[model samples]
Target: MTETSPRPLRVLAAMSGGVDSAVAAARAAEAGHDVTGVHLALSANPQSFRTGARGCCTVEDSRDARRAADVIGIPFYVWDLAERFREDVVEDFVAEYEAGRTPNPCLRCNEKIKFAALLDKALALGFDAVCTGHYAKVVTLPDGSRELHRASDTAKDQSYVLGVLDERQLAHAMFPLGDTLTTKDEIRAEAERRGLAVAKKPDSHDICFIADGDTQGFLAARLGRAEGDIVDEAGNRLGGHDGAYGFTIGQRKGLRIGHPAPDGKPRYVLDISPVDNTVTVGPAEALDVTALTAIRPRWCGRAPEGPGTYTAQLRAHGGETEVTAALEGDELRVAFTEPVRGVAPGQAIVLYDGTRVVGSATIATTTRRDRTTAPTA
Candidate 1:
């Protein structure tokens, strides 16, 4: 494996009061870097503590981070980026939903907050690179250009969320957990051996701002009740819903359609239109899409180098399929070898070449294939 750093340098590790980050800071210190642990106060409500694995980014989380920093023998500080997190991540998430899109707030956090905001601050504070416990690898290629790749453990790989980071942000980022053969349990065991406080802390899975995990209720309070018609593709009204903004593409639950399908299968949410206030539901087969268009593409490396074939990953944990990709102005157009399901607009479409992450873009549109397009054998 390539060296994490060429020389001993000052590094800032963003400890999220978790075992992974605690172990990461420990590894960075072991690597002989001048490491300091910093915890981000990202939650708007600072007084609330992580209760029963529900809310993260609480006072408890920050305290745990400081305790771990103490155990790691590093100076610890808390930076209150609550305002920036609210504006960049929380607001953007609500805005995307208001516009009828499924937004990934974790991606936004990595793109605008964790890497951009935190890294910028670290640079001003004289840190060489900002370290985190993200489960993704950064390696220097044969030609010396740095590249980001999936973690050794596919089950825990977080490259999909980290794909939004460009080359510059990645250059100054360190992920010690990415190169490890140690599983999560082993990391926690290391934390226990080291006596870190967050050794058994549960992982934060929900959107940090939405503490209750009721996305529909959370959105309803923000966007208000804008009830609309539920329709099929042919504009036939099937039923009515509380609000179109609350629904998402490829959603099959809580559709509230009274009738059952002729084939005894269930209908799924195929599209959500905020402009017309419509939720379109159809059979499961209607979700298959062959071609997709993405806007505002951001490259992690040199912009694709005249794109030929790239493995396009459609979802965070979704499988990748071979695709024919090309750039069209500032947008990316890709044709999938097979129709993909659950592809929604406003979600990110990350591209990869082998294990190296190429870049990502927000999905703009998708074209479903018709039966007439079938090739004769």
Candidate 2:
């Protein structure tokens, strides 16, 4: 007697017209899954289009995605997600900057627009799972809970930005490029062999919404000119800045201070006070931070109950450091094992355990430890 083959799962592949995502869709097809390709139309401003290595949602990218879908023999559709993208990603970016916070728009795009919105739509259309080109993994535990893990390629690991995904989102997600792939070169090479158009396309860089990789220019265009005084640690005026929104914590360059420090060293931006219209300058050592407090924390699989130690990374591509983390109501208090340099406010602090993502939160404030000498022996 002959046995019947199992039915193929229906998957919606989010193709960004890039080599990785193209290969991801092809791989899903090869796995005997019924796959469809979707390219999200995200950009609203026509002036946002620029021929550079950074822009991803341009007309060229959309055409490339459509061609890749044709090559893979899948039904392709371009969803007009411009309204949602602007509201969730671009608008949120502007609001964060205006409020003196540096926000990661890509992470917000992934969490809100891509996964949440697109995933829900796919499910409503009878798709079993939504797949992406992210270099991360989803695992099913013995207790029937899904867990998110880092990709095999540590250098290309994207778990840091994805740590904000909750358990429900992880369950409905699939990462087709997670387990087998290592370097981007290999993926592009495979795409070339498959005769895909985006095989040699350069990866998108910087913030997608910022057309020319000019955050200052973008902010000035949106928030207008708000000139402010540059001050010292003692609240003495040193010079002037274009805008407080243009500066961030621990920035050294672009500070128009004419004179050097008292010890003949370069002065760095230690603080940006929107209230006083001032940017504080100080020594590099002033950038070191020992503790960080975060608001709106989100755990991946489950939230930690009590004080527990975990490795925390403050920025994307930043080195991880051991930190004692505790849950205080809706906030997360993190005490670094050693002093971490340049812990900026408004950045996301992601906690990890080995290859698994634990949780993440936005840095509300960071406090430095005061060095005090004991009594003389």
RMSD of each: 2.1, 3.7
Which parts of model 1 are misplaced by more than 4 Å?
1-3, 47-50, 53-55, 372-377
lDDT, candidate 1, 1-120, per-residue tens = 233677897899999887888888988998999999998998668654345533258887788888889988999999999999999998899999999999999899989988999999
CA lDDT, every model vs. true structure:
0.86, 0.82
- As a whole number from 0 to 100, the lDDT of residue 366 in candidate 2 is 90
What are the TM-scores, per candidate, against the unseen true structure? 0.95, 0.94
What 10-residue stretch in candidate 1 is worst by lDDT?
47-56
Task: Assess candidate 2 and give its lDDT.
Answer: 0.82
Range of the 10 consecutive residues with the lowest summed lDDT in candidate 2: 1-10
Which of the numbered candidates is closest to the native, going by highest TM-score?
Answer: 1
Candidate 2 clash total? Answer: 0
- RMSD score of candidate 1 (Å): 2.1
